[model samples]
Target: MPSFYSKKDLFFQLFENQNCLELTQLPYFSDHSKETFTLVLEAAEQIAEKSLYPIFREMDRQEPQLVDGKIRIHPAMGTIIRKFGEDGWINAIFPYEEGGQQLPWVIHLAAGFIFQASNYSASVFPFLTTGAANLIRTFGSKELKEKFTPKMFAGKWQGTMALTEPDAGSSLSDLTTTATPASISGVYRIKGQKIYISAGDHDACENIIHLMLARIEGAPSGTKGISLFVVPKIRLDGAPNDVLTQGIYHKMGYKGAPIAHLMMGSQEECEGYLVGEAHQGLKYMFQMMNEARLGVGMNAVAIATAAFQASLAYAKERPQGRKISEKDLSKPQVPIIEHSDVKRMLLFQKSVTEGALALLIYCGILSDKIAQETSAAKKLKMEALLDLLTPIAKSYPSEMGVKSTSMAVQVLGGAGYTTDFPVEQYFRESRIHPIHEGTTGIHGLDLLGRKVWLQEGLGWKTLQQEIQHSLDQVKSIQELNDLGHSFEEIFLKFNHSAGELLFKRNLGPEKFLADATLFLEASGILCVGWMWIKQAISAQKAISSGALEQSFYLGKIETARYFMEYELVKILGLIPRFHAASYPTVTMEKDWF
Candidate 1:
């Protein structure tokens, strides 16, 4: 079997580049060390190799089916979920009191990267459960937790976040899902439909727990009235709830996990236990949503990484046309890897997958820091920074992952388009990410309209300071000074463009956000550029210290250079568009099309 991911690079990003071991210093994670982290990652790899990757293609081929009103998925999923739970993966990052190891979120995310790279579809089940269960642990009542979490944590019950409805996909405020009070104090009758719910309905587990969002029957309209509920497919009394698996979506990719369309209370029998307080559903769901956003970004990176690996392996073994300079007819064709274009494509994939992984890991580190931080002021600062980067972290990888995986397909030429290679599946899988968690456009608005202005722009300022700190560190290193200067210059230009656009907020929401997606793209590039600079600085320091892996360090430096020269420079082109006074897109008539 071909390698789907690089453990060496993952360790480099975690330990050498990001210094994730520093997280162990916090009391919350003090019990853990590098050795334990390594063991966890090794175990994840063993599981991925043994259970996940071997069936990667098989899962995709045999997509889930709605059989006799029950959604049936790959047979291995039950065993996989049980294995994840048995090995403490679902609750791995929770506090010790919660029956967890107090592991760092960064390490857990890193392990998730390995599994996702091995098999994107199979990997979704556990993480979705993790996110849903986390919501319950964080906001659910003690009784709710007691009744639901043990089974979820034990893999006997699957957890899902059911938010999207047919009429309200991204517009949460418009969701019409209704909840009525039940005879019981904390229970409500959930009467609404939820669509496109991932892992929403699966027979692999005995029961399905839905972290559902709904509005109370007489509550105020819009988002203010929204509330959260814990709706189960089966009642606690072992009787069926009215949560029906109405249908199943046959997706273009990510076929292993069923995307369920469900109807609740059709028989007026669905019982929903209220989670936390009423009228704060959106607020509580954000915790899971934001985490899911980062997970979506990582999912994109992992699939692209898998595709890159497949293409890379094929390039090394497949003999193709001779170099342009070779004229002799008797000369044997060289491996495709020898070609310049192929190298460029491979470099693009590497720069994207590695750079994006670094950014996601950095976000994970921020999450860890925020969790352990005691000082209210300091925690707010970190929160501001993390909030600002969330959309960028989610959007950049998702948007660029498409191009990166396409490059993988291009590198393999005709073989990449066929089922003979895995790149095509990866290509299909990569398309879902930009739409998942939240669409790229939704995140763009979140980034520019909301997150950028968070805490009166403290997040933006924090990001600038962080980037400049990296710049300061690299400026003194002779090997990296030029690249450092290049990034600084481009970043300044990007920042100036952003400032000019922000100044236009007074013009109206439409005018300001008409090009928000462009702003998002530029910000994503600049952020990834900063990540690359950080990596280059680490690689340069290691090289200066005479690290044994000379080639690995050198490759890191070259990939960083490629990103700075090629990918990062594209931000310069977007800078001018930001300054455009009259926006045609905003003013264009609806009937013009």
Candidate 2:
């Protein structure tokens, strides 16, 4: 089988570009070293190659089905989940007292990327459990944690974030799910339906645990009223909990994982255990949502990286037409990689996947730093920066990954259009990321309408300082001075445009957010540009120090150059739209459509 991802690129992003090992210096992570991290990655790779990749196509071809009220998935997922638990992956990043390794989040994300690239459909099962168990460990009562996490960590039960109701897809305040106090303390009767729930009702485990959102009876209206619950498919007494799987969604791609539509209290017997304080569910769920947002970004990069690998392999081995200058019909055709256009396409994929990977890993490192920092002031600053970048990290990779996977298909020509290749499936899977965790448009609004001005613009100022520091470092390197200068110019222009937009906040909500998506696109491009500049600086230093793989380092610099010239320049087109006086998209009548 062809390689699905680049280990060299992953290691380069983790160690050289991001300096992930520096995280080990933190007292919280002092038990670990670079060797331990490498071993974790190797273990993930072994499982992915042996259990997941070989069944990638089979799972897609034969999707989950709702049979007699139970959703049955591929038989292999049960074993996969068990192995993940047996190997401690489910609790790897938790505290040692919690039966975890005190692993840094960055290392965990790196190991996850390998599984994601190998088989994204199968990969969701265990990670969802991790996120759910984490929510319990963080906010649930001692009884809740002790009861749920042990089985969850053991892979005996599945976990899911049950938030999206039919009416409350993105608007959580409008959720209709209701929770009433039961006869027992700390337990409520949950009576609502949830839809589009991933890993909601798979037969891979003995039980399904949903970290769900519901509104308490007589609670305040809007977001303040929301509450979270731990609702299970099977009660602790070994009896059914009255949670029903109404139906399973058949999707375009990512068919291997089931998306469930559920009914909670058809018999009025569903029981839910409260998590944390009442009416504070949204606050707690944001923790999981933000983490999943980054995971979604990595998911995009992983799928695109896999597609790029498939296309690269095809391009190198599949001989095609000769160069345009070749007039001799007798000359043997050359591999498609020899063509300039194909090379351009490949470079675009590389630049996007690698650049986005760098940004996500940077965010992960920030998370680790925030968790371990001793100084209150520095921790607050890191939190602000992370808040600022969360939406960008989540949306950029998702939106661009679709285009990157499409380019992979284009490189393979007609072969990519057929099922004979994985690129097409990758193309389908890529579409979900933009819509998952929150749609791109939603994040666009959140970025411009909320995140930019968060903590009185602390995140905004901190990000500028961070970028400037990188630029300052790059400028000292003679070989990268010009590229650094180019990025600085665009960076200033982007800030100017963003400043103008922020000033428009006084105009009204609609006017301010009318072009928020455009602002998001420009910001994404600029942020990726910053990541590439950092990468270029790393590559230049490695070359100067006599790195062994000369071509790999050289390619990093070239990809950075290509991004600055081609991708970063696109921001210019968006700057003018920010200055426009008229607002058509906001004012246009709906009937006109």
| CA lDDT of every candidate | 0.93, 0.94
Q: Could you give candidate 1's per-residue lDDT for residues 1-593 as a string of tens digits?
A: 57999999999999999999999899988899999999999999999999999999999999999999999999999999988888899999998889999999999999999999999999999889899899999999899999999889888899999999999999988999899998889899989899999999998999999999999988988888999999999999999999999999999899998999999999998999989999999999999999989999999999999988888999999999999999997999999999988899999999999999999999999999999899999999999999999999998999889999999989888888999889999998999999998999998899999999989999999999999999999898999988988898998888888889999899999999999999999999999999999999999989999999899999999999999999999998888888988899977899998
Give residue 326's lDDT in candidate 2 (0 to 100): 98
Candidate 2 deviant stretches above 4 angstroms:
none
CA displacement after TM-score superposition, residue 117 of candidate 1 (Å): 0.4
Which candidate achieves the best lDDT against the true structure?
2
lDDT of 1 at 144: 90
Q: What are the per-residue Cα lDDT tens digits for candidate 2 across 1-593?
A: 55999999999999999999998888899988889999999898899899999999899899999999999999999999999998999999999999999999989998899999999999999999999999999999999998999999999999999999999999998999999999999899999999999999988999999999999999999999999999999999999998999999999999999999999998999999999999999999999999999999999999999999999999999899999999998999999999999999999999999999999999999999999898999998999999989999999999999999999999999999999889999999889999999999999999999988889999989999999999999999999988998999999998998898889988999998999999999989989999999999999999999999999999999999999988999999999989888999988999999
Cα-based lDDT at residue 202, candidate 1: 91
Which pairs in model 1 have colliding backbones? none
Each prediction's TM-score against the native?
0.99, 0.99
Estimate the lDDT of model 2.
Answer: 0.94
